[model samples]
Target: MTEDASPRALITGGSRGIGRALAAAFAADGYDLVLVARNEERLEAVARELECGYGVDVTTVSADLTDPDALEEVYERATAGGAVDVLVNNAAVAVYGPVAETDLEAERDQVRLNVAAPVELTKRFLPAMLERDSGHVVTVASTAGMRPGPFLAGYHASKAYLISFSEGLTEELRGTGVDATVVCPGPVLTGIHERSGRGSRWLERRFMRSPDAVAADSYEGIRAGKAVVVPGLRFRLLPWVSRLLPRPLSRRLARLIIDRGDPLESDR
Candidate 1:
């Protein structure tokens, strides 16, 4: 495909936060969008907003990706458009407590949504991208994936799996024009914190970037076919800093920084 060709981007979790910003950014860049999320009302609202604001075609699919049955449907829904020029694997769930104290079903949902769903989606969509020899797959992993998270263990592990999977796929498609880029962003101002029963206020004070900033960086990196893009300076420094510290020290530091009290208790 040429530069002028109108690309189509499929983004998971596109109703709000980083996913919504990515969708809007892609629409502004002249890419048609297929936005997937579980909330139908919110998704439709975003679709209308993007269509009216950017003059682009916006499709919305409402499905819970945590269920295996829904995963099959989500895969089909994802590739419904003729050709997906870009795939943004951004749908994820997070649990913020000690592993033993966390609910088992919630942990399973994290694995299903964050790990299995993306892997399956890539397997389904990447073949056509490889054949076409001109497409990009961007997985929104996290800097937390660099090490074992003391509190958010399941979420961290899932992201680490996603990063590893993306890296391996990039190597596999090295010669092919199909590129895979992994984005390791630290906490951004997203609904994730609100949903995880946590808050972004502390992170906001420290190094939390806006969804718009993260989205912009992601678009450029994916377009340039960069292997990995870390959005902000502080977040970019995290993985390296974690590497330099002793394993136990690193875990302790992570716990201290990530220890957000019950998000539901906020004065909303």
Candidate 2:
């Protein structure tokens, strides 16, 4: 399709990491873009990069999606230009310390960004997609959602909520041309861990997939109308393994993997 006639994709957190990669992927696939992020400079940089590189139209919205008013503004701006044929809810935050040690305010913000933002955005944008009878919703969840994670309890739980919400929404849109695909990626070499003040460099190097690889898998899975997209071979097996193991054993394994250091280190 020509650029003017191409579909448009609105990707949250589009200024960096998986979201940025997805923006490039969609642009290359002939889609115009609405890139949303909190940093205007970064958003503009990404928009210019995509437009210059792929010769596709690009719009940038700078807003903190955790704020209700900011999120509404994003919705208005996104729809103001044109219909968004693909909605990629890729924005999220996480708190990685023990629940008691983590700041409650920070954890609340994490839930707001990771769970509430996507849920509300999906609810608002889905009607237009259903009316058009053609749209795609891709939510970037995590393998952390598949099972209980001790050290990162709040983050994992928030992602679990997103995964469940996307799965149910996908089934609800069965006959409609609109579709929802939740992507569950394991560790990724992104600034998220650094920002969260958690994650070991050693563990990240061992298990993390590249952002580009994750984005490519996510884009292809959404195109194929898959309900769940796990980006790598090891991550793809997580849900199955979680399901097979007894709940207590699974939780223990999750704790071991997530803690990263001696549990006593937090007490020191």
Q: Which candidate number has the best TM-score?
A: 2
Candidate 1, residue 176: lDDT: 91
Worst 10 residues of 1 by lDDT: 259-268
* Candidate 2 positional error at 37, Å: 0.7
Q: In model 2, where do residues sit more than 4 Å from their true spots?
A: 1-4, 260-268
Runs in model 1 deviating more than 4 A are 1-5, 200-204, 262-268
**Clash pairs detected, candidate 1:** 197-263
- Residue 264 lDDT in model 1? 29
120-228 per-residue lDDT for model 2 (tens digits): 9998899989988989889999988989988789989998999999999989999998999999988876667666666454655677677898888888888899999
Candidate 2: which pairs clash? none
How does model 1 fare in lDDT? 0.83
